[model samples]
Structures are given as C-alpha cells and as structure tokens.
Target chain A: MTTVARADGSAPELLDRLAADRATGALSTRAGIFYLSAGHVVHVESPHSPDLGELLTRSGAVPPAGWWEAVERAGTRHRVGRHLVDSGRLTAGALELCQLGALFDAAYCALAHGGTVLRFRPGVTHWLGAVRPVPVATVLHESWRRRELLHRIWPDPAVDTAPLTRTGGTGPVALPPRRARTLALVDGVRTAAQIASASAHRTFHTLVELRRLAADGLVAPAPPPPAHPATGAGGAAWDEPDTALLRRLLDALEAL
Target chain B: MPGIDESLLETMRLPGARGALVADWISGLALGAVGEAPGGDAEATAAETAEFARLAVESGTLAPATPAVPATPGTGSPPPPPGSEPPVQDLILTTADAYHLLRFVSTPFDSTVFLYLWLDRTDGNLALARIRLAETADRLVLG
Candidate 1:
C-alpha cells in the first residue's frame, strides 16, 4: 500500500512528460514496464496480462519448440516478433495483433493504479522490439476508456480478482463460444488472470466476460474487501487475489 | 504480403474508398488506418465498429455455427482448425450514403479482429470492395 504512487506525478502525468520530451526508453511503474520509442508506447509487460509467448504458444498458434527457436535466434536483438514473421513460423498480422492486444491488456492494469513512475531507463528497449508503436495520448486515453467501459458493464471490480465458478444452479446455460471457453475454466480456483493465460484470451476481454457473468448471476464475485489499503481507485486489488497473482505480480514488478 | 500500413493503403486505392482501419474487435483498437474516418475520429469509429462487430459475432443468430465444433460427429466434416476462417467472415452495413464493411482477419491464435473499410456508396463497388477487402484481410501482415 505504502509502495504505490509515492511521487506527486502518477502514471499518466509521468508518461505525458516523457511523451512530451519525445523520449525513447523504458518507463517502470509499480504494475509493469512500458517501452516507449520517441514518446510512443511500443510495448508493455504486466502481471495482469499474459505475455506474448503465452498468448501465442499457449493458444497453440506456434509449437513450443518453434517459439524457443525464434527466441534463440532473435532474443538478443529484441526481434523475436520479426524473426517469427521472417522465418514464416508466424504471420506478421498475427504477431502484430498479439503484441498490440498484449500491450493494451497489460497497459490498462499498469495505469489502473495510477502508480508513480518507479524508474525510467533511457534507451532501454523490449526484446520484442517495436511491433506496433502507439502514441502516448492514444495509449492513455484507451486505458481510461477501457476502465470506463468495464465499469459501465459492471461497476464492481471484485469479480476481476475473484475466482469464478458456474452458478450450477441452472442447467444448460447458453453462452457465446468465447465466453463459454472462459467460463469453462472458472473452477473456483483459477482467477481471471489465470483464465486469461490459460485460455489465451486478452486480459480486458476476460474481464468483460467475467463482469457479464457476474451480471447474469452465473458466477459469484468476491465480496468487496473492507477498505483494503492495497486497492486501486475503483476497488481493484491485485494483492491477496488468489495469492498466486500477488506473488507473480511481485516477482514481475520486482524483477524490473 | 502487405503489412497493416500497406494493406490500408491498398484499401484506400479502392474506388470510393474513403478510409479503412485494421480494428481489433476484442480490444476495440485501430491497429492501423488510412484515409478518412466517417465520424472524423478514427479511434471513436474503431471503438463503435468494434462494439458492433462483437455483438454480431456473439449473437447466436448472427454468428455461424461454432467453427471449432463440427455439427455432426464422425461425419468426416471435421471442424475448421483454430485460427482458420473466423466464424463471421465479413459484415456489411449500408448507410444513407456509405457502406461500412468489417472483414474479419483470421490468425493462428483465437482471432477477434477485423478490417473496417468505409466507402462512398456512389463511388464504391460493394461486390468488388467485398472481394478486395477479403483479399486484404488475407494478405494483411502485422509484424
């Protein structure tokens, strides 16, 4: 709790300044690291969003061995994405979509806490390179819009951190295929973040589906925490959220 | 193979093509865009079109039978592989003076995105645009 947003400038402000300066480097926040090129957000890695490898290989897009090969060949130069495309193992369109999806998915959580910019290293770049560079204004605006959209669907954020399970009270609950795939993984043990990785679904899309499920009374949301100090502005708490999430978040955040 | 920028440029070359965007339905993001946006705001248009596209794909009546699940078991009609043709290939919305086409882009992984092309009805060929848009979706590279 005490570790969040100690600086007067939060995520948006810090990013705005960097964007204004047309800075190219990595900006570290409490939630994740955002790689910027000439003030544009090129890549992002966060605990809330599954990494590119998981999004690709875990979804059966590329075999584990093939992915490993790409990393071996291109990891050092931060061109794993380009290498995958060039090697014909993956399409440029597919890689781009995945990276951009991963970018916004994680960036939403990264900016959610309004965490202070922990540290910024000039000229530091992601190993994935610049797959799709988006302006800082667009990135920031999209993050805020996503938060608003999710809130409109379901105001409470508890469902986000809660483990989900079918109500099981009703038989034959018809659902869209995507939501069905997501719901099928809700075993009351795996939370939304786990479901995102396991299902190869975008983090925000997973949240949208879960919020809808909660709206439909299909899954029980975690009861609102009692004014936890670790919660974000909208009562979003990644801490003690299934324990595993917190640990991974810590490892990912600390490793930076 | 055309990357996003190049693909959009190709779309712009189409007759009556006012603008086009590589929009992600799931995230409602414009991966790339070229030319004009109907509302004069590309991002807002991307979000709205994405919302419309998602509803179409999610609604059982609109979406084709699940591609992953074959209708008949052991009938030799195996379901399409993942990342194959999307359940909804393309959606055409006819407006008062324009045609909005959303062509879903299939990927190796679960795909939830499309190419949105806005064309002037008088200048654009719906049939040709449909064919070309689909071709663009097929060849539109990302990396």
Candidate 2:
C-alpha cells in the first residue's frame, strides 16, 4: 500500500525539479492543480478546500457584491485577485493572506493522497492571477506535515467524509473552544466538509476536529449511507416497473 | 503588513533563533518557514510541535472553564463559551541545548496556526524571545 502510495509521491518531487529548472506551467493532479510561474507555485486549487472567493465571502472579508463585481470585471483577464485589490474590495495584505491560505490548504489535500496522476501543461496561469507565489519546497513540506497531522489525530480516513452523529444521548461532553464551535454545526447530515462550510471554518481544521471528536467518542461514524436495497430485496420493484410506463403510454394514446 | 512570510522572518530576527515556522495546529501543516529547522527537517519539526500544541489546546483540565449556561428558556444544550480567543497563548519546551516556543496566532478565519521558534538555549534570551514572539503573533495578518 505504501509503495503504491509512493508512486504518486513523485508528483511533489517532479514539481521541485521543475522549479529548479524554472519551468512554467500547471501540474494537474488527481485532486487539484498547481500553477507555477518560473518554477514558483503561483496558485493551487482543489475540490477539497474552499476557493478564495468563497472563503473571503464567507468570512465577511469581501462582500458578495464586491466579489461578483471583481469576478465579472477581471475573471476574463485572469486577474480576479488583482481586481479585488485594485478596486479596494480587499486590502493587498488581506488578499495575500487569503490567497496563500487557500493555496496551501488546497495543496495539502492534493499532495497528501496517493495514486495521483500528474500532468504538466506549459505556460498556464490561474484565473485569480498571482497574489503571492510560494516556493515549491514550502508547499511540499506543508503537504507532508498536514498528512502526518491528520494521521496522528485519528489515523482513519473514514471520518473525513462520513456524516457525523452525536456519540450518545445528549450526555454532557466537554469540548474545546474550537470543537464547541464545530459541534454546534454538525447535524449528522453534514460531512466534515459540509460542517466546515456551514460553520465558516477551514475545511482542514474541521476535518481535524471531527477526527479528534470521533477518537473521543463524542461523535459517531456515519452508518454507511444505508446501502441501497440490494437487487434481491428490490427485485419486486424492478419486475413491476411497467405499470407507470404502460399508464403513461395509454394516456398518450388517448390524447392522440 | 506582516503576512505569513513576513511574520516568519520577524521571528528569525530574535537572538539565538535557529529556525522559525508558521504551522496550523489543527492540520499540523507549516504555512511558512525560515532559517534552519531543528534536526534539519522542517516538516518533522512542524508535526512534532503540532502534536504538543494540539494536546495542550485540547486538554480539558487546562482549558478555561465554560461560563454558566445562559438562563434563556429551553436552551436545548449549554451555550458554548463566549468569545473565540483560544486558551493557549504560548507554549515553551526546553531541552538540554535548545528551547522551542510555540506561539498561537489568532485570526478571524477558521483555523489556528502558531509560530514555532527553535532557539539555542546557550545564546537565546528566554525572556526577550517570549515578549517578541507575542508581538509578532499579534501583528500577523491572515486573510
């Protein structure tokens, strides 16, 4: 398992080498893409982490109207961040901080998982433009650290996506400040990511807190989405499906 | 003005500072780093420090006691502690030859990240380093 995981581990190494060569392009991974400029990682995006636009709006850093205006105006030119900063929708410092946070957060998920197929496209730029280009080495090092952190917390990946339920019947449980904030938002229907979105917290932090809560038995693991009734149990429905079809056909013939 | 990289660079200026890194305690990922890492590996150091920070922040005994639940009628559960300031301000670990300082940075965003500074015990001024770290953590601007 480790070897198979290590196979894709070369993605980061290849990125570092590309950085050494001052290569410019995008490295597409199974989870996300990293856009590099002259070997420096200018931007990264992933399905796991919320995008900068959403993060900013959710945090009240930038209003929805402002974000929309910036996007509508600069999205075509691939300079959304620049537009936000230039238009004073966000301070340059704030934009840099949010941009970097979004980049690293996405990179953590992109590089941590294994079996990722990596492909590079030369001379590509992210739509947000470059707020701050992080060193390739820094991104790799942080991604490795994030993986270790998650493992140390729970050592289980199931908690990452499972719906959360209270462990027991409302028994009093102690929660740290951060966990308490997160617990208020979990309704058993939301996965870690959903809770993060609803709570306006970092997705990575929400996952870590969920893992910790799971380890302490404060939350129960999702009972695998009640597996769809097997064919054997639902076989009768499949056998009888013609009634609705036949009724619809009869109605259509009568109308004709 | 002090973003992640600038904040890290500020920490490296303290006397006897061996290395400094900004790492998220929740995910244990280093946001930015400067100088040389202890044991020559920044990632390992971030993970180790994150473990210590997580344990300290999450300890019920060390956590500040929750205030009494509000008297609002039929509040299904106790209201969480008011105010979002994390209990831990800074943590320091002393070894035979070096001191490790983990200073948590407060932000309005979802995550908690701390600045970790490894100082040479022989040359580091513990008192001065602590004061400076606090200031840097305060001024760090995170989006």
Candidate 3:
C-alpha cells in the first residue's frame, strides 16, 4: 500500500488526501481514533462511536433485512447510531452502549495493528498502522469456536449483509459434538420457508439449524432471482413469460 | 450509608473474602473497591478485570446465550445479540485457597460497571456469595 504524509494537519485533510490518492491503509489520530478499510470499515473502535450494524443485529432490535435497508438508505448522510435512534429502533442508553462497544473493538484492532499517525487533515486524517497478518487457520479456528458457542453454524457472510435464503446442494456434512436426527431432512433442496412450513420447531431453531448447516459447508449460496424486463409501474408484465413466472413465485412466497 | 461502600463492606463479610472493587467496563476505570489490595494493587486488578469483561463481550465466546432487552428508542441501538452478553458479571474463580467473584451491575445511568470480589474458596459458598453480591449491586449508586 502506498503511504503519503500531508503537511495539512487535520483529519478531513488527511481523509481528502487518501480519497484523492485512492490509498488503502489504517488512518489514526493522536486522539486514538482510527478506521480500518474492509469493504467499508471491517472494524471501528473509538471513544466516540456509533452502534455498528452487527451490534444492532445481535441485539435483536432490528431484523437483518430491515437493518440492511436502513443502512442502504442512510448511506453516509446520517450517523448510523443517530439514524437508528431517530427511527425509534433503539434507545439512548442502548446507543451509548453500542457506540462504546464499537469504539472499544476498533481501538483494540488498531492497537493490535500498531497504528501510526501519517498526517492530520481538516475533517480527515490518515494514520498508518501495523498490519497483523491474520492466518486463514486462525479464522477457521475462531469460526469453529464461535460455532460451538452459538450452537449454530453460520458460514455465510451474506447472512450479515443480505436477506437469508436457501440454496440447493448435495454434500455430506459432518456436525460437531453430535448431529441431530432432524438435520437429516435438510437436502439444500428446500427453502427456509419450506422447512418452516414442514417443521413444528420454532423459527429461531430452524434458522439456527440452517445456519449451522451452512457453516458446516453443506449448503451453497442461493442464486439471485432472474431480472425482470422493464415494465411500466403497475403495468402488468405478464407479457414476458419468465417475468410472469418469477412474479408469481414471489407473490406466492409473500403470501406465505 | 453510601451504597457502593456498603456493598463493598458486605462483600468483605463473606467467608474468606479477600478484596472487593467496583469498576466501569466502558473506560476500564475503577470507581471504588476494598479488600486484600492484592499486595496493595487494587487498581491494577480492577483495570485487568475490566479488560477481561470487555474482551469477553467482544469475543462473543462468553456472550450471553439470550439477547438483552432492547432499550427504548432515542436511547440508541438495541443491546448486542443473544450469546453476545458476557457471563462473568459475577465470576467465581475457584482456586485452591480462595474464590473470586466478579459481579456486574448495569445502572440506569447506562454505565456498564461491576463489583469484583475475592473470597477464600475454603470458606465461601459460591451460590450464597453470588446472591449477596447481586443484592449489593442493586443498592449501589454512582457518585
């Protein structure tokens, strides 16, 4: 990664330089605030921070789909924490806790990486931090540990960003501890909705089971639905057979 | 008459009580604490314990298996997910000589703090100590 230092001592200026240069590296300030770039801040920990989307999901205050929609809508216009609170999704106390948590996590990551201040800019600053090479083995081990703790396997990153879906696949999966007899019914052929319809278990339990299965490398990511031909708003597009069929399926699912 | 000090004193009364301290998990700062001083080193232990709590919560390994109740809107985002809450709020470490219990108390002020206790394992009833600690935490008020 290319590193550049700016004489302008301001956070905004540093940020501008980075954006102008299209540079990717850890940025920090003397104040101990720093940002890591991983598809947009894989981690951020500051004394002052917002509730991360991950924190919101874990809190169970917002559904994953709902949170994603909010994020997309908010983009960078609104402070995420403020947006969530304004939307009546969280309380002030909860917001404070979440912000603290995010900041703490980000700080830990920054410290672990041995971050250095590169330059200060007005509103934007860049700092270089030591990059700790994370081994894939470490990730896998942590994943396994998480699996054991949550008692559910969640191998898909999409679950964190997009709506959950089921994809069909054929594979022999080995579950840790002991495999439940109920898991025998999962063949990747059934949608989560379908499984829910057929089973008497709670939705949370079924979802957890699906996540575990996905984590065990037994299930594949679901394919995106085919695009529909452009049609007038409210214009019946039954003219295109595929569009009509997909529409019908979506409608059916919505009804269910 | 002060709540936190009284709580600390009560913790000391427990069988084999070594020391007791209160800490803020957010900033890793100790508010008030008493006991063994661990060779006159309560601050270090309090800071260390706070770090432990923070790490445990962030690691998601020892997080509570159930989700915390969502705070009312305007308070910010909801609590962390199920299995994201730490369980060592009142940690009881069993050693050959003493039992250490750290109990966390979430005040209405939104400060995530806890009381750390050390008791002699030989004389402590792990369960009873936990109950008393919980009660003590409830009565505590931050200065």
Candidate 4:
C-alpha cells in the first residue's frame, strides 16, 4: 500500500493538483476512490456513501433488474450509462441527476477521509462511463458548503454517526415527500448511514435532512452503542499511528 | 426533454437573462448553473433560494389544498388526497433591478428540483418568461 503521509498535503490539494495536471483515472484512498476523466471528476465511490446503483434503483427510476443488467453488460463496452439511456430504462437527464447527486455525495465522504493511504492509477475508468463531468472546483465548493449547512443545523458531529429517535413532543409537522420517506426509515436502531441505505434519498441529502430534523427537535441522538468486549483487537484497522496523525491533520485543515 | 445542461442553456437564451441555476431546494444544492450569480456566490444564492422553496412548500398558508380524499372513520390521520398538485408552481420575485423566477420542476420520481432564472427587469418580459419556464419545467425529465 502506498501510504499517503500528512506531508503529501490535504485531499483538496491532491485533487486540485490532479485537476491542474489534467490527470485521468482513479485516485484510490484507503477510504474510497475518486475517478476522473480529462481532469473533471466523473464519479466518486466511498463505503460510507450508498452506491449509485442503489440510489437509482431506490429512486424508482430504474428497476433493480435493469440496473443489474446494465452493470453485467458494461463489460468492455464501458458504456453503462449510455446503455441505460439507450434502452429507455432512464432518460439522459435522470441519469445525469443521479450521477451528479452520487458524485457530490461520495466526494464529500472521500474528502472527509483525508488521511487514508492515497494511490493514483492513471487511465482507470469506472464502468458507469461519464454521466457528466463536474468541475473539481464546484465539487469542492459544494462539499464545503454542505458541511457548513450541516453544522448550522446541528454542530455536533456525533449526531451524524449515531442512530436517531424522535423526540416525541412536537405535533406532526408536515414533511416534504423525500423527508417523510427518510423519516419513515429512521427506526431508532439505524444510524444515518443505515437510514440512507434504506431510503431512496441520496446519502448526503438524507444526512442533511437528519440534521434539519435534529434542528427541528424532531429527532435526537440514540444512546451510544453498548461496549462489545468480543470485538476488541479485531478493530485494529483504524488504529494505525499514521491514520491518527492524518486525521488530526485533516481536522486542522478543516478547521482552517 | 432537455437534460439539465441543455435546459440551463435554454434558460439563459431568454432576453436579459442574467443567470440561471437548477437547484434542489431541499438540500440547497445546485445541480447545475450558468452565467453569474446575483450575489456573486452560487452556493449562498442556492441556500437563500432553498429557504423560499421550503417555506412556500411547507407552510399550510402557502400550500395549495389537495383534492379532498374522504376521511376514514377509524384511521388516526386520513389518507392524503390523491393527485395533489405541487404546492407552488413558480415563485416570481420582482426586485428593483431584476425578475427572479423560481420554477419548480416535477418528475415521475420525487420532484424537489427547481429552475432559478435571474432576468434584468428592464428588458425581460415576465409573462413570456413565465410561459416558457413552465414549458421548460414540463419538458424536463429528471433521472
């Protein structure tokens, strides 16, 4: 593993440099990877973010079978997005929206995982092809703005990772369809990530809604998870000294 | 139907068009934008526009009443009336120098996106713009 050290600079800087160089292909960080084409960001995939296929399938735009077929048939064609559009499974517009939403969603999490071991493999394209290439500047700017919006509503970062439950006092306030859909999935046992997986809304948007709901006093953080003694030492993956140092560096960078 | 990029370009073709953006009001994120922003900051403008959208759609005073669904006797809350139109079609804000139109776009899927058009008040025709914007919104196909 090509461990990217704190001396390599921040994730934003790395992306900026790649864009400046007009680099093409995948930049793999330990947390996830960002795929670029001709310097523009084409796709981003992170474990913390729900997959684009799942988001699209759940959106009722294309059925699961159609999505699976697209993935399977992408093979050497590398035109998964085009296949879907040509097959009338979805419109070019809808595909663009889904790709854009997923890009921003995954990019945010990728940037958050700043200190991971970073490796860039040139000419590595995603199977989805390029739905639409978003400018790197816009992607970074929007992610930063989204982070601010979340903080404005609920400053506690803990609210983001914890399971949520209704506060139970405010009379039913009418929620928008997506928010209502998301709220229905918040069963008090699922974290924000889990809730996003269950709902059709994009993961980032779901988290934003959760923060908004938190601000409205409609939801509160569930108590911490019980201590699992059996899981000890097995969780050593995140305890690397470099990882801790990188996280601290990221925190300092974000604070700036 | 025009995808977001083409739609945005079409919007800017309107007379006196200052700028245009396709924004998801729920999350205050811009799907796409062209030309300049009113405040010179697209992100800030999106957030401000979202506040308007959230208010217009959420407020009972502003939300249009749905075609009434017969209330069931035993259900705690009645089933929502079928086929309710979106709360607001478009919101037009006439400032001293510009005409700001927030046209909500509907989709077969959940519709939370809207077109924000900023036109110079002196030269832009509001009536024509309104009609064209609605047509654009109708023709828009969101994936």
True contacts kept of each: 0.46, 0.38, 0.00, 0.40
lDDT of 4 at A30: 67
For residue B37, give model 2's deviation from the true position in Å.
Answer: 3.1
Query: TM-scores across all candidates?
Result: 0.84, 0.73, 0.33, 0.81
Judged by DockQ cut-offs, is candidate 4 incorrect, acceptable, medium or high? acceptable
Ranked by DockQ from best down, the candidates are: 1, 4, 2, 3
Predictions in order: lDDT: 0.79, 0.73, 0.48, 0.74
Residue B115 C-alpha lDDT in model 4: 86
lDDT of 1 at A224: 40
What lDDT tens digits, residue by residue, belong to model 2 across residues A37-127? 9999999887777878778888777788999999888988989988987786655545665677788877876775552656777777777
For model 4, report the TM-score of its A chain.
0.81
Worst 10 residues of 1 chain A by lDDT: A1-10
On residues B28-112, what C-alpha lDDT tens digit does candidate 3 reach at each position?
5455667676557876777677766655543434443354655544322233334332333456667677776777665322245
RMSD of 2: 12.6
* lDDT measured at residue A231 in model 1 versus the true structure, 0 to 100: 36
| Colliding pairs, model 2 | none
TM-score of 4: 0.81
The TM-score, computed over Cα atoms with residue i paired to residue i, of candidate 3 is 0.33
lDDT of 1 at A179: 75
Clash counts for all predictions: 3, 0, 41, 1
